[model samples]
Target: MGRSSLLKRIFALNVAAFVLAGLVLAFTPATVSAEIARLEAAVLVLVLAATAAIDFLLLRRALAPLRRLSGLMETVEPLHPGQRLPEEDSSPEEIRRLAVAFNGMLARLEEERRRSVERSLGAQEAERLRVAQELHDGIGQSLTALMLQIDRAARRVPQENPLQGELCGAREAARTLLGEVREVATRLRPEALDDLGLANALEALCARVGDQSGIPVRLSVDPGLPPLSPEAELVVFRIAQEALSNTLRHADASAAELTLAVGDDGTVTLRAADDGRGLGDSVPGAGIQGMHERALLLGGTCQLRTLPAGGTEVALRLRTAEVVA
Candidate 1:
């Protein structure tokens, strides 16, 4: 036989209770005549009211767990997982089973979301690598050849010739353009991360940001940190980059600090703080949301908050054990 549903159980309980009450009344000496006395009528009304109050209390108690679960569902955020309903021993079987099923569903959804983000970000990184290579190998080489030709032509011209000045200027412009292209390529795909490792890459990033933005940036990397997968490393770097970029663009800050450290339990943390006007009532923009999404892909968390004293802080935490690798 199929298991009884909550509604059916409730209906059965109410029907049995009413039938027992009727049997007790029929077996008792109490009788209802065509015209009843005022005291008897009052007593009947009180009995009916008492029975209704008991039924209401029983129904509320049975549905309380479901109501609590509904409230949790309403408040749960899709981007930030981990919310779950409590499955208490005292709860009805139906409610407990529902809680278990809902929790399982949340886990599956979170895993699917993580996978989707991984594929999307992986594709993005691949594209960046391709574009960076093209800029460095193709246009960059052409610019280099152009600069050489300009230099040779300027050398051939007489020192006093007006055209020599134009050639020199042209060469200088080409050199500047080449430098810019290289910088863009570096930004698109950081070679230092592949060559020098995460620590050095972060140090170079801080230096470059400070040079470009005219803001001092300090970096500290813990010694002998635990190893992180390439994806995890990239996520951390990107979050740091976005945090610094936001500070440079909107914080109006003069200085910033970036730190990488491993916790006692082997959790890796990346934090960036800026000494600037804090975000006050401003909603998180795309960059901030991107940082959060990147963290989620690594099964990590990214938190952005304004410091009490001044400025803003972006903190990213990843558990080494939970990382998907």
Candidate 2:
């Protein structure tokens, strides 16, 4: 029975016992009846007090498991998936059943999360590849041919001719367009990341952002860090790209820093910090949310917070083994 219903029934029994004692006393001789009535009233009071104390203890015991379950939930992590609540042999039957169902639900959720991340990452990479290829083969080659033709036509024109100036201008414009095309291609997908490694790719990224934004960027990476799976590498690279982009666009800072460190226990830490205006109760943008989702998909943690002094910091941590492809 529910604890409340049981308590109500016990209270009713107490009331009935008091009523019966009063009725019995009413039929007895006058003096004796008064004395007996007083004794029964005292007994009734003691019984009610005892029952209230018992009810409180019963309720506390029945609810203790839920309290423990809540505490365990607070510590659960997506990174370390599939952990189950403990079902002790001594636990109440209801609590054991609850724990079993909770564990099953967690398992299903983790599985769905895995599938969703894989699908998302696959689609993202495929789209990037397509865009990069089109930029490189279509627009890139067309612009190159145009630049060559413009150069040839400019050469054929007389140096003193008025048309020479316009031809030269046309060639310059084509060259600028070609440069932009190459930049777009690179941003779509960094070939260096696939050919070289994370370090070289990140170094190039830092240099490009600094040169373009006129904001100095410093990069520090651990030399002895173990190599990560390709999927994990991509996730880290993309997150760093987004962080730097946000810094350049919104930070309004003169400098930024990126750090990649590997711990002895195989945990990889990535941090991006900038000296600029702080977040200050503002909501995160889509780019930041995307970075966070990507990290979670790979069983990693991403945190963005304002520094105590000023500016903002983006931090990510994940164990290498947890992100195996």
Candidate 3:
């Protein structure tokens, strides 16, 4: 037979207790006169109080598990999944079924969220690639040609002509514009990642960030690390990029370090640390959340923590199989 509902169980137990009390009173020889003595009134009040205490105890025992479940539900975090209520055999049947149903619902929600994040990040990466390619191939090439034309014109102009200086200046301006365009393109999508592989790309990224931000960014990579798929590499690079960006903008640090290594259990780990003022009470901003989402997309974990001694660290761990696959 299906288990009874919680309300029905509670109501039946309470009614049975009350009925038993009534039967006991009916069978007892003691009788209360219409004008009762003080002793009789006192005894009646004590009986009612005892009955109320018993009822209260029974109600608390029956609803304790539900209260616990409600507290846990309040603490559930969407991004961090896998929390579930205990489904012990000793628990009430109603509570056990409710726990199972709630756990299943959480599992489904997490799966749906994972798929949504996958689609959103996938589209974002595709758009970045497209824009980077256009900048490099279309506008980039046009600027190159323009610079060449300007240089040729400068060469043909007589050295004594005042107009020759203007041509040189124009050529220099075109060159600078071309450099800026390439920089922007690289930022959108690093070509080094596609051509040189993760290790070199990461090293180049650190060097570039250090140069631009005036902070010393040290890098360490394990030479024996296994190869990673392009998507995994992109995720790692993006997380590192964001972490370093945060360090530069908010950390107020003088130096930073980025390390990539493979664990003995074949997990890939990336860590970025800076010796700066730690994140005190500040909440994580969009950049930090993006890092977390990227890691989740790759079936990895990302953590941001403040060091005991000083500064902040962003650590990411990914199963090697997930990255390689």
Q: Scored by CA lDDT, what does every candidate get?
A: 0.86, 0.82, 0.87
The regions of model 3 sitting more than 4 angstroms off are 1-12, 32-46
lDDT of 3 by residue, 1-325 (tens): 3555678778976996687667655776545679997876776677667777888888887799899988988898876766777776666788888889999998898888888988998998899999999999999999999999988888888999999989988988989999999988998898899999988999889998999999999999998888899889999999998899899889989899999999899999999999999889999888888888888887788999999979999999999989984
Instruction: Write one digit per residue (lDDT tens) for candidate 1, span 69-130.
Output: 88877887987787777876666679778888988999999999888888988998999999
Model 3 global lDDT (CA atoms, 0 to 1)? 0.87
- Model 2 weakest lDDT span, ten residues long: 1-10
lDDT of 2 by residue, 221-302 (tens): 9986778788888888988999999999898988999999988888898999999997888888789878878888777889
Score candidate 3 by TM-score against the native: 0.89
TM-score of each: 0.90, 0.79, 0.89
Candidate 1 minimal-lDDT segment of 10 residues: 1-10
Ranking by lDDT: 3, 1, 2
